[model samples]
Target: MGFRQRTMENLVITPAFWQDRRVLVTGHTGFKGGWLALWLQTMGARVIGLALPPATQPNLFELTGLAGQMVSILADIRDRDALAAALASHRPEVVFHLAAQALVLPSYSRPAETYATNVMGTVNLLDAIRQTGCVRSVVIVSSDKCYQPRATACTESDPLGATDPYSSSKACTELVAAAYRSSFFASGDHRGHATALATARAGNAIGGGDWSTGRLVPDAVRAFADRRPLLVRHPEAVRPWQHVLEPLAGYLILGERLYQQGARFAEAWNFGPGGETAHSVADLLTKMAGMWGGGATWRRDDETHPHEAQSLRLDATKAARALPWHPRWPLATALQMTVDWYRAHLDGQDMVAVSRQQIARYCECEPKAVAP
Candidate 1:
């Protein structure tokens, strides 16, 4: 299909664009990557996954049996040669770079590893892309924490700064992508490569199968399942929380636009939830506890934890106007879906079917105006 035709179709994720496409997703063993890989696979794309083994037991990647469905490569993104070799072998036309040490508390303890994995690992991947010249569209997944702390919602043009190692590394990651886009992949480059690269900054993603420690939803699930009181850290902290599929949908749309129109869509984007979806951690836990009926309880943690932002929001107006993407599932629906998935998992049901059903349902959903 032509660029005009795609734009007329509103650049929504269509199977026609992804069918039989050669795609590579780094960090496919992780939570967001696992979902993206699965969605692409369902659209008939040939997906190549590169990352270390699953970080936690009962992770989404392994539980959904994603490894068997795609080309799963167990390798560290920190290894430059390994990344280059994998890119050369896969020769993918689309690349999604998601491999990183993706947590805040862990970054406080292991700052060096966080920088090495998030900062240098990105350097390795972009440099490897420079060597293997087949890639067309590249979307680097960054965090909303990459923005400088502020009282209002952040836009793509906001000043990028962070005090925490994880957030700082992501800020540097965005710089790395911008440098590569300007130096090597410039639209006027004479190298004959048309790789359109961009960065995606999203808000807090709460969904099923994120078994990572230090995150709110997963920690709640583990605590509630064990019949223990969940510990709440920074309960008053407010975030623009949305389902994992919200930002993933934005990434897919951005990738497609980058491939078809190149420089026109090659820029940073914010795929955050609507303003009404912003809620405090305590509020989220209350709703979750209500959904998890049998004696689910939580209490405030008094531990002196490391500093985290009390408020983080993103202005996704650029995405809403440009890519024409809007969040489909409201916070209530997102929470219900998340709780349903875990409840099914706890019952030992086939999670693969459950996960796919959610994806199908999400695809059919229309955007609704969320009430504040």
Candidate 2:
């Protein structure tokens, strides 16, 4: 069916939909969080960001200058008291929880910190919502890695488990959400009258402005920028890559569903590309090199690192059918947009305008409606 010909049975975006809506985004200084903050601002939402200080130099948060766009709070998610105070003062209508020790390698180095931030930090946010009694909906951002190893594209109903510290901690966060939603947010519970919570599993994301150390695309870009050979680990491993905004749009749409349907829509959802394309690290590097005009090369990392998933893909059909969600940019276009952003920044273009322009471009291309 044509995009416009499809029925409007699911939530979709409009310019003024988020106007006057209060949204609290944790991890606003991080890569995906920064993008979400900027997107919400474009929708005219009142966004308040809560997270630890932006990471050291070469950070996406600082690179995008997102702190100036929202009420950025310098606090750790593990600090329940601080998080609670911020939630109470802000009284957000919707909360997007994205703060965590997001790196798998670092999680191996500091397993305890990972658990504290990912597992307990989630508990803290849930407890704070219980206290505030003002939050209407919350979307807990998790990863496709939360699923147990499977060669096929995993669905949301597949068993949930994780091998590494980072993935396992996210699994624990999912458990926390399940428990709280069942125990406290049920129809008969005291706090059930106020809030509904859900989880979203996003596939591997790639875009510009990401400067995180150890990530594939960012590492490649940084090494190339410095005229060094990028290191490639697990070059044969496959991932479902899409632009960052694709999943962010899914999260916001799910948030809107939770607002309308309340407990009925409070369930786990997957946001990813429509199909599995086994784009390995080598394949991604080749794509990036081609997009960057052929001056980049890579070598395998010598030191042994934590194990990441060998192959990963997700089935977002449920989101497509239930929420009418569809990915706008295909794989090649996503990579080109990423490379173009980095090129613009390196060429001394105004990055703030560049980022905003990308956001506008994505929205304009978004499919307004679709058939299941």
Candidate 3:
């Protein structure tokens, strides 16, 4: 199959496409991966999750009861033999490679571990996939920070560079994917074993069930729930924030295209909210405080911290034109959804049902233009 122009009407994620398909999701215990795995389950995919135990105490993977839903394998991606054995046994038709050292501040303290996990971990997965020979579509999740720091929005064509260890590792991860794609999974290979592989770079994704340390939304949720003030670092740092579902939707669509359309869709893509959604940390916190409605507050931290990017944006025009994807929820709605999820959790509500309801609502939402 070859790539064809898709209309907005058909851009909605097709549950029929994923139904009963064998899918492998690495990092299924993390926030984004958890959401993706849950969504796949809802669509009746036979999901196989391979990753270490949840890193945080109250992580989404356990909170949502995902272990009971899929075949959850406790293993590390850095372990080459284990990873290869797992892939060989499961033989998934689709793979979403998301396991990595995702946090930036932590990367400063654990640089070697970060490189080994993000860079070599990727090498392990790609090599395993090549040997396993059952995967037809692969979506490798990278970060928008893979681009060199710039004041403007970054396009997929932008040069890949990074100042921080986390970002540098992600750039190297991208290079590894590109190398594997070109060498083993090249488009239209005569050997007839080519795999359609693509990379997705997304902006700051905020949502519920994310208790990871050093994140804005989770920290705010904890502080507000505890009746304490949230401390802010780099309050003026600007990020193109969107609900987690936005990029997850992009990943699903990209995976589908890679499976059905082969080479044309096998390339790097950017999935981000519109430019108008870009806001400073302070601005986001203020809005979050108002939404929380309990006098939740934040103050700038005086302690010196490791360097972080002040401004970052992504140009998702390629995805918009090719996959015909767009942000369905605006920032205000996204923040409200986040607050609502935490409030439900605090109230002892069933988080899996709440999360599933949000996913259904997101799928039903019509694409709206970003409000300035």
What TM-score does candidate 2 reach?
Answer: 0.92
For every model in order, what is the number of clashing pairs? Answer: 0, 0, 0
- Model 2 residue 132 lDDT score: 89
Distance from true location, Cα of 120 in model 1, Å: 0.5
Give one digit per residue, the lDDT tens place, for model 3 in 22-65.
99999999999999999899888999999999999888998888
In order, candidate lDDTs are: 0.89, 0.82, 0.89
Q: What is the lDDT, from 0 to 100, of the residue 204 in candidate 3?
A: 96
True lDDT of residue 52, candidate 1: 97
Task: Tell me the tens digit of each residue's lDDT in model 2 across 1-372.
Answer: 422212122227544557779999999988899899987886678999999887756566776777676799999988889988998899998899999888888988899999999999999999999888888889999998899988888889999998999999888888999999888775333234468889999888999888888788888888888878887878888887889988998998888877666876788998888445537788888888877865788877777866888988888888888876888887788899899999998898878888888877776674532211
User: Ten-residue segment with the worst summed lDDT in candidate 3?
Assistant: 1-10
Q: Order of all candidates by TM-score, from best down to worst?
A: 3, 1, 2
Candidate 2 residue pairs that clash: none
Model 1: residue 356 alpha-carbon error in angstroms: 0.5
